[model samples]
Target: MIDFQPISPLQRTWLLELGLERAFLARLPQAQPGGQSAPVAAPAQEAAAAMQTAQPVERHLNDAGSPSPSAPAAATDAMSARDQALAVLRKSGARPVAAAPVEEVVQRPAVLIQPEKAQDMASLLEQVQACQECGLHTGRAQVVFGSELLSEPDWMIIGEAPGTSDDRSAKPFDGKAGLLLQAMLNSAIPNASVYKTHLVKCRPLGNRPPTQEELAACRAFLDAQIRLVQPRRLLAVGHLAAVALSGRDEDLETLRGQALTYTDAQGRSLPLVVTYHPASLLLRPQHKANAWRDLSLLRELQNQP
Candidate 1:
């Protein structure tokens, strides 16, 4: 039997806005003539079908980065993630306005490990474990690199930085947050292979935020991991991970629930989305509605080839 947890009124509103209310209220399984259970209702099936067939919505911009006449009008809450992203872009004066500032803040470090130096994920792991790029490394109990890389992961989950449990376990996304993350991911994309990592490898002292210099220091390692894993999509949880991965320091509200892109050193691009961290969600249950919307966006991306 499928267990259906009761959802909040806010969550109901979110589902209604996204046309997913039926999916949540999908009929329970019933026994068939041969004692076999009937297939799950079309509500869930249709949702999955929509996810599988939904093409990314695109909008063209003029020379000044303003939306062309061909661009779609303002997207409402009901619009798809891609549509919402395009809408957000349109409102922000699109890329032409924001490009220069973004580029200015996102500069490469003076020195980083070359691809030739860390050829594969294994070699990169060794180098990362020995990383001493920033002061965070000095007070760290262990460098929480990440889980083992999936040769071809469907999703690459990036978190802000290591927490207390992570530092002790020498793993990224540990304890309650990790469990919640896993549950959420599984709910969205069951059996889909995922690789988890953090923006910064080592934990900061007393849980203070890592400095900008520290994030820059370990940028190469993160980039290398992305290159090696080559995941189809990236889900950056929390403001710091979103900032580090997207190369944009916009507010989390401006960043989340939108279809973004992340480009690696090799120029390979992947679909990216930012959402509230699971830890944050734990503290503020109200935000799970927003996170669910982000997950729906992620599910849409995963459906595409």
Candidate 2:
């Protein structure tokens, strides 16, 4: 018969120094005080147990904590390569070896267009047409500026970028998706008017994902639109739009129906809401329930006195 022993104070202290808790040290035979048998855990079993125990901490430490459903394979490959390099160095008996710093590479500089400060919409349109700060500018067929009434609007909707139809039309939110977005707004605000725009001006090649650079380069234009509209409420659609506006990569699931605040050009705090993109909803109809909830929250906010 085997009996388990309690952990030693010295070993518990060592494990604690390594960022592990005394409870975890107590599970390991090496840390256990002498005189009793301990149940040996297989390496895989030990790893599984550790993972289960540390899951919450791991989530907090991760940048987004949740996997992006739309993350590209190339990005995953890059991450794997980095992990492999670190592993090889560690296994090579390299003394004092440290993991490389994960530098967030920005593909391009962001632009800030404060349309409220602009002389007129025509001039803002001209500026958007000529802007070329990212590689997407070269690949685009046309630029999608934005659409809004000449008069002031109560609501403003922002999306990630131009799709095939939008790229060809140079209009933000055209086609079935546009129709759906309009319907959603009309349902919520009955008599209220809503403005629409994209984060990036140009359409990415082959409808490929917009890189960080492309989003950054066009940030100014979106910012400018917000300043000009000064809408009572702003709705950021899509993961990219949410991240661009919030300055954080939070999952749409967690962000939906939640109210956030963004600083406008005048540094005024603007109320913000996040929702699934019309395009995404078209792809995954199941998310429409959540979208409806978000839209309902937006309606409630707008109706608030």
How do the residues 237-299 of candidate 2 rate in per-residue lDDT, one tens digit apiece?
Answer: 998888888777778777777899878767888789999999888898998888888888888
lDDT of the structure predicted as candidate 2: 0.68
Q: In model 2, what are the clashing residue pairs, if there are any?
A: 110-216, 111-220, 112-220, 113-220, 113-224
Candidate 1 C-alpha lDDT tens digits along 214-242? 88888888887888788988999999999
Query: In model 2, how large is the Cα lDDT of residue 283?
Result: 90
- In candidate 1 the C-alpha lDDT for residue 158 amounts to 92
lDDT of 2 at 64: 65
Candidate 2, superposed: residue stretches over 4 Å from native: 1-117
Off by over 4 Å in 1: 1-116
- Whole-model lDDT for model 1 versus the true structure? 0.72
**Per-candidate alpha-carbon RMSD to the true structure:** 30.5, 22.4
Worst 10 residues of 2 by lDDT: 52-61
Which residue pairs in candidate 1 collide?
A: none
Best candidate (score: lDDT): 1
Q: In candidate 1, residue 74 scores what lDDT? A: 35
